[model samples]
Target: MITWMQRHKKWLVITIWISTIAFVGAGFVGWGSYDYGKSSGAVAVVGDRKISVEEYQREYSSLYGQYARAYGNQFNQEMAKKIGLPEAAVNLAIQKNLILSYADDLGLTVTDEDIAKELVKMPAFIKDGKFDKELYIRVLTQNGTTAVAYEKSLKRDLLLQKVESLFDINPSSNEVNNLSKLLFAQDDLSIQILDPKSIKIDYDDTILRDYWNINKIKYMSTNSYELAISKLPFVTVSPTEDELKEHYSKFKTDYKKEDGKIKSFEEAKDDMIKVLSIKATKKDALKKYLALKKDEMKFDATTVIFEDKLPFSAENINEIKTATVGDVLKPFEGTDGFSIVKLIKKIDPKPLAFAMAKDMVKADYLDIKRSEKINNIAKEAMKDFKGEHLGFVSRTSIDKIKGLNPNEAYGFLNKLFMSKEKEGRIDLGEKVVLYKINSSKLGTDTTTQEKSVKDILLRLQKEELMTSLIKNLENRYEVTSSLDNKE
Candidate 1:
C-alpha cells in the first residue's frame, strides 16, 4: 500500500515548493500592512482588539532574523524588502492573534504535556538521536527565545493545528476511487488544434461600449477615502558599537550554522543511493511503458465529444476494461492533468473491498465524525442563544467564524434570511447550522451602499486576476521539484 505522502507526492512537491517560496519570501508573516507606525498600519480590527505597530515589528523582526540566520547569506535585506517583509510580518502576527482569539472563544486549551510532547518532536532540540534538554535551552537562548515563550508558541501551534483539523473534510472511499479513476483512466483517439488566427472579434465601438457597460462593475472606480490620521511616534532602540560587537560574537555561530543538522557521508550514503536507484528504475519503466504503448496501438477510429457530452467510445470502454501492463490508450484531456493510461493491473469493480478502501473509508468516517462533533458543539452553544438577525449577510460577514467556509456561510445566511421566523435551522449540505434572525434593515444612503458594492467588486476582481495569473503560469510552466529528493 502506498503511504499518503507517496500517493500525493506530486501535490506534496507542489505544496512544498509553494511553501518554500512563501517561507523565503514572506517568512511566515501573516496578513497585514507592514507600515506599523503609520495610521494605515492596522491590517484588521476584530472589535476593539487592535494589532499595534510595536507588536508587529517585534514579531516581524524576530521571524525575519530567524529566517536570515536559517538561510545564512542566502537571505538578504533586499530580498526581504522585495517580499514585503514588514507587511508579511504584521499579517503573520495578526493572524496568530486571530487564530488564538478564535481558539480561546472555542475553549480550546493545550496542556504542558502537549507542549513537551511537541517540543520533543522538534528536530532542533534533538541531539545524539534523542531529545536534549540542555541543547534545546542553549539553542533557544542563542535565538533569544525563552523556554516559556517557546512553550507558548508550541501550545498555540498545537491548538491551531487542532482547530484546522476540525475543518478537515476527508473524501469518501467512493470519492477517492472516483477521483483516482478520473485521474488515471485512458482516453479514445482525438486531436484538437485551436487556431488563434481563425478566431475574430469585431472592432466596433458600440460593441466595446456594450461590453464595458455590461462589465462596468468590473472596471469601475472605488470611493477612495481621504484621511487626516496621525501616526504613532517611532520608538528607537539603538545599540552601541560595543554592544553590536558583543551581540555579533555571541550569536554569529547561530547564523553561520546550517539550517538542518549535517549527517555523516556514511549515514546518508545508503539513502542517497536508494533515491538514485528509484529514479533510474522509474526512468527505465517509463521508457519501456512508452515503447510498449506505441507498439500496442490497436485503435483505428476517431470520435469527437462536445463540451456537454462524454468523450468515450465503445472501443475506448473495451480497451479500458481489458487494459493490461504496457497497454497505452489515447491521451485523455482533463481539467488539470492529461492522462495517458497504462494499466499496471486490472481488478473487477465489485462491492467495496475493505482492504482496498479501508483508509479512505476511515477518512470519510473521521470527517463525518468531526462534522457531527462541530455541529453538536454549535448546537449546545446556541441552546439558549438569542441573537440579532442579519438581514442579508454576505460571505464576508462570517469570515471571523472558525470551521466554516465563506460560501457555506453565505448559503446558510441566505437560507436563514429566506426562512420563516420559526424555521431557525438550515441544512448546509454536510451539516445543519442554526442561525437566529433578530432584525432586518435596508440601507438608505446610496454612497455607503455603493461603497460596499464597490469593495466587494474590487475584491472579486483582484481574486479573479490573481487566480488567472496563477493558473496561466501553472499551465505554461513545468515545475518539477521534490522535497524528498532535495539536496
Candidate 2:
C-alpha cells in the first residue's frame, strides 16, 4: 500500500513538472530612482513569459513545507538556509519559465477539458470513489492553493508532457539483447571473508599518545551547554486508544513497510503511543514555556551540562546555546522528549590532555591498527591467491561459497560487480572479502534483458533530449532576472 502511494506521489510530481511554466518578472515595484526598467513585478522574464514573485513563493513554500513536514523536529530555518532552499527556489522558478517559453514556441496547448479530466482523476480530489468539487476546493485551499492556480499549473504540466513526448527514442530489439547480455553476465571467483576479530593489534601508551597529539582536535570535547533543564519525559503519559488511532491516521506514511503496506493498528499501536506521547510532552512543554514566559510558573532547576555525549543531539545543544543566562528558553523536542532549559553557562570545546583522553585515544589507536592489520592480511592473501588457479563464481552464485554470511556474500557480490580491475577486496565490517573474477558467461534471460535495456534507453534519451531542449530554449529566449536586485 505504501509503495502504491509512493508510486502515485511520484507520478503526481512528474505530472506537475510536465505542466507548468514559471515566469519571473524581476523588475522593481516602484522603489528607488532612475526608473530601473519599469517594475514588471516579476522575479524573472523569459521571452514573453513573466515569473511573478507570488508564483516563486508558492512553489518554494510548497517544496519547503513538504520537507519541513518530512523532517518533523529536525527541520528549521537554519537548516533550510544551509541547504540553500531560497536559492533553489529562485533557480527552480527560472527553470520553469525557461521550459514554459520553449513549450509556447512549440505551440503546445492544454485545454480546459484536459485539466478538468486530470483533476477528476486525482485521488486527492476524490470522495466516495468519485470526483467531489467541494472536496477538491477544500483540499486545494487547505494546501494554500486555489483551484484556478492549480488548474493553470496543471495546464502547463500537460504542455510539458506534450513537448517531451515528441522526442521519444526507442532502441532496437537486437541492441537491447546485446546490452542485456553484458549487464546480466555472471562472473566466477575465488572468495574469502577475512575476520577482523581474528586479527589482533597491540599499541603502546607512547604510540597512542603520539597518535592523539596528531589528531587531538578530532577528540576535542563537544561544545556543551551548562543548564538547568526540566525534561517532560513522554514515557509518563498514557494515551487513549482513540488518540493513538487518530495519530496513526494522521501520520500513517511514517509506518509504511518497504513493500508499501501500512502496519495494522495492533502491529503499530506501541509505536503510535510513543509518537503521541512525545507530541503530548511537547505540548505540555510549550504550556510550560508560556507559563515561564509570563512568570506564572517556575521549574525546578537541577544544573547539568547538555552535550552530544549525553544522548541529546547537536540541534538540542544549539537550541540551549541560543538562550542567555536566566532566560528560560522555549521548549524544544529531542529524541527522548521535550526539554525546557535555563542557560547557566556555555561550555567551550577544549582539547583534552593525554592523561585525560588516554582511554579514548587508546581505543581509537587500536581501531586504526586493527583496520591496517586486516587490510594487510587481505593484501597478502590476494598475492597468494593470484598465483593459484581458482574456479570462477557467477555474479548470482556467491551464496555457494562455503561459510559466507548472507550479508557478507551480498557485499562481496556488490564489490565483484563494481570492481574495475576484475579483482579486489571489500571490507565488510567484521569480515573482508578478496574476490577475483576468472571468467564471465552471459545468461539466457532475453525477456528481462529486453525490458532492462528498453527502460535504460528510454530514460537516457529523455534526459538527453530534455537537456538539449532546455539549453536551446535558454539561448533562443531573451531571459532577464529581477532576483539579483534589491528594493
Candidate 3:
C-alpha cells in the first residue's frame, strides 16, 4: 500500500492508510492500553449508597477484562474508545445504583441464602462438582479478600441480576413465531454482481482533468499528523504462584487442557503469568498516560505522514484525522508497550492536483458508470441475471449469498423483503448486486427453524422491551457520577 501511495503521491489527498488505537503500544505491538484513574477515596453517590473507590476500580477492571477477553490480542485502546467501554462502565455503574434505588422503592431484597447460592455456583468455589466452603475461603484469602467482603460484593451483583431478570419477561409463542417467519420464509433469488472491469472508458489528459474539475471535492490530499509520544514499555511482572492459582481459580473455565477439561493450576501457570503481566502493564500504562496528560512528562516528536502506514491501525489513523491540533489521545498499544500520544499538528486535507488525481478520477468514473449501466439493466431486467445460482434463500440466509459478504447479504435480504418490487439493483461500492425474486413461499423448512434461532429472537424481543425500561428507570432516579471527579 505504501509503494502504491508513494507512486501516486502527486495526486494523494492522503488516502486513509493507518490503524486506530487499541491496547497500550508505542510501535504498535501489544493488545492495547486503558486510561482509567486510580480510585482515590470515595466516589459518586447514588441513592443511599456511595460508589466506593474499590467498586469504581472493580467495575472498570471488569469491563476492561471483558473487552480484553473478547478481542484477545486484537483489543486496543482505540477499540475501547470506539466501543465507549469506559463510558459504558460509568453508565453501568449509574444504572446499577438506579436499579438498586428503585428496588429499594419496590421492597426488593436479597437474602443471605441468595448470596450463598450464587457464590457456591462460582467455579472458583467449586471442587469435585460440589461447593467447597473451605476452598472458597482459601481462594478469597489468597486474592486478598475475606468471605465477609466477598459475600457483600456478591450480594450486590446478585441483586442487580435478580432486578434485571424482572424486566425480561418471557416472549409469547406468537411473537417467536412471527420472528421465525421472517427468518425462515424461503425465496428464490437470481443475483448478478456487476463488475467495474466490464465498464470500459477511453481516457485522455483533457477528459481526465475535466472529470477531476467537475468532482474536485471528491478528491483530496491525505490528512497527516505530527505527534509527541510517551511509551510505557511492558514490564514483565512475575506474579507469585499463589496469584496464578488465584487467577486460575477465579476464571478456570478460560484455560482448557488437551482433553478439554479445565487445566490444573500447574499446567496453566505460564499462560496465567503472561495474563497477569499484561494486566499489570495496563495499570502502569494508565499511570504513565495520566502523567503525560497532566504535562508531568513528555516525549520527543515524530511525523505521521500519509506514506507512513502500518505504524498505527486504521482506526487510530482516522481518530488522528478527526482530532484537532493539541489534542492528546489516550495511550495506544506499542510493539513493546503503551504510548501516550499528543497531536502536535494536523495537516488538513487539500485538493489533489490533476496529475495526482487522474488515476483516482478514472477509477471513480468507471465505477459510477458501471453502477449507472447496471441500474439501467436492472430497470429492464424482468428475468434471469447470469451470475451464481443461489438456489433458495430465506431472509436470514446470511451465508448463502455467493457474491456478497454476510453483512451485504443481510442488508439485501432486508431490502428484498421490504420492497414491493419483484426485482431491484443494490450497489455495494465496488460492485452491484441485481437481484430478482422468482418465487416465494411461507416458512416451511423445519431445518431452518432452529431452536437456537428462536431463542436468539426471543432474547432480542426482550432486549427491545428492556431498552425502554432502562430509559424509564433512568428518569425515575437522579444519578450523580463522581467517576470523573468533575465538580
Candidate 4:
C-alpha cells in the first residue's frame, strides 16, 4: 500500500517546482560551461558547500522550465523576473546545501556503487538492457554536460537521499491504530442540506447595477491577434534501423504497451520511426522558418482571431500571443503538420460596458444574494434543528450521503470530524452542509490496509521530523549568500 519511498517527499516549504527530469543528461545541463572558481563564480555558501553561478543557473532554469510547462506560453523571462524565481532558486539551493551539510556532519556518504546503481536504473542511460557508457557519453555531450560534474551532482542528490532515509520511521501497530482511529472517527449527526435555489431572491435591478458598477472590469473582451499563418507541409522520412534503435534506446519508457510491459523493437519500431522523423523534420522546418523570418518567404494565409477561437492549440496560441508584432514563432506542432506563425498585429482587451455585461452581472448578483440568504437560513436551522437524522458517518463513509456526491460527502464528513463545535455549517460551493453532532466514537474498520495507516503515520512523523530538523539545521549550518553576484 505504501506506493512510494518516503525519501521522495523532500521539501523545505513544500517545493512546488520539481524538475521534469526525462534524462540524467537533462539534469546535467550547464555544468560544462562555467569555471568553479574560488570566489567569483559562487552565488551562495552553505558551510563548505559553495553554490556556484553555474549551479544557480541550472537551478533557476529547472524552476523556470517547470513554470513554462505548467503555464505554457504565458511564462516568459519577464514573468520569471517578476515572480522572483532567482530568489526562489537561491532559497532552494540553500535548503539543499543545508541538508547536505547536515548529512556530511552526520558522516553520511554516497559511494561510487550507489551512483552506478542509480545510473543503470535510469531509462535514458540504459541501452541494450545495461548502462551503456558510449550512449551515456553521447546523451551527456548532446545536453552540453560532462561526466565529472554530472556525477558530482548525482553524488549530492544521493547524499540527500541517504540523509532523508535516516528520518524514515516505521510506525508500530499501536501507533498506526491510534492515528487511524483519530483520522477515521465516526460521528452521530443531524443533517440539513442548504441548496441556494431553495432561498428565493428579490433579484433587484439596483443590485445588478451596483454589481455591474463594482465588477465591470471582470467582464472584458479577450485580447485578439492579427496573425500571418503559414503551414509547413508534413515531412515524412524513413528512419534508418540505427536511428530508430538509438531513439528507442533513449525513449523506451514511452514505448510501453497497455499491460505496462516495454514493447519490442519490432512492435514499437513505427512509432519510434515517427518520433525520429518529427525530430529530423524540425531541422528543415527551422531552415524554412529562418527564411520566413526575414520575409524571404511569404505567408500562406492570414486571420484576425480572438483568444477563445485560436487556430492552433492553446499552448501554441500562447506562444503566438506573447510575441511582439513582426516577431515570428518557430514551427510548432499543428493538426496537419508543423506551422510557423508571425504576429502581424496585437489587439489589447477592453472592459465590457454595463449593457454588454448585464446578464453576467445579474447572474453573479443572484448568486451573491442566494449565499447571504443560505447562511442566515442555515444559522436559524442549526438553532431550531428540524433537519433529517443521518446516523453515524466517518471520513470513510464516502457513499453515506444520498444527495451529495462522493467528493462532497467526504469533504463534509472530514470538516465535521475536524470541528470542535457540535453544531456548524460548511459552505460547499452551491450547497451548504448544516450538522449537529449527537455523539462521537473512533472507527473500527479492519477491512482497510493497516500498512497504509502505518505508512500515513510514518509519513507524518517524517514530515514533522524533517521540519524540526531543518529548523535546527538553520542554526547548525553557517550560510552566506551573495546571489546578487553576476551570473
CA lDDT, every model vs. true structure:
0.45, 0.66, 0.65, 0.74
- The regions of model 3 sitting more than 4 angstroms off are 1-43, 141-146, 165-168, 172-175, 188-191, 204-206, 216-218, 222-349, 382-392, 396-411, 445-450, 483-487
Sort the predicted structures by lDDT, highest score first. 4, 2, 3, 1
TM-score of 1: 0.32
As a TM-score, model 4 comes out at: 0.62
Ranking by TM-score: 3, 2, 4, 1
User: Evaluated with TM-score, which candidate comes out highest?
Assistant: 3
Residues 283-345, candidate 2: write the lDDT tens digits. 888988888767787766765553765445556666666667777877777766777777777
Worst 10 residues of 4 by lDDT: 1-10
> What lDDT is reached at residue 365 by model 4?
84
Write one digit per residue (lDDT tens) for candidate 1, span 95-124.
455555566667888898877777777677
| CA RMSD of each candidate after superposition | 27.6, 9.8, 11.0, 8.4
Off-target runs (Cα >4 Å) in candidate 2 are 1-93, 120-145, 202-217, 227-345, 353-359, 386-411, 427-431, 471-487
Q: Per-residue alpha-carbon lDDT of model 3 for 1-487, expressed as tens digits?
A: 3344235432322111111111211111112233334545455677677776565545555555554554566655555655555555556666667767777887889898787766666676679999998887776544445677566666676666666667655656676677676667777887877666676667677877888899999888876667787677777887777877778879876665422245678888887877777778889888877877788876755656652452666666667777778888876776677767788887667898888888899888776777677767666663545555677787778888876788877887887777787777776666667877788877765445657666787666665665666678777766677646642
Question: TM-score of each candidate?
Answer: 0.32, 0.63, 0.64, 0.62
* Whole-model alpha-carbon lDDT for candidate 1: 0.45
Best by lDDT: 4
Residue 67 lDDT, candidate 1, scale 0-100: 48
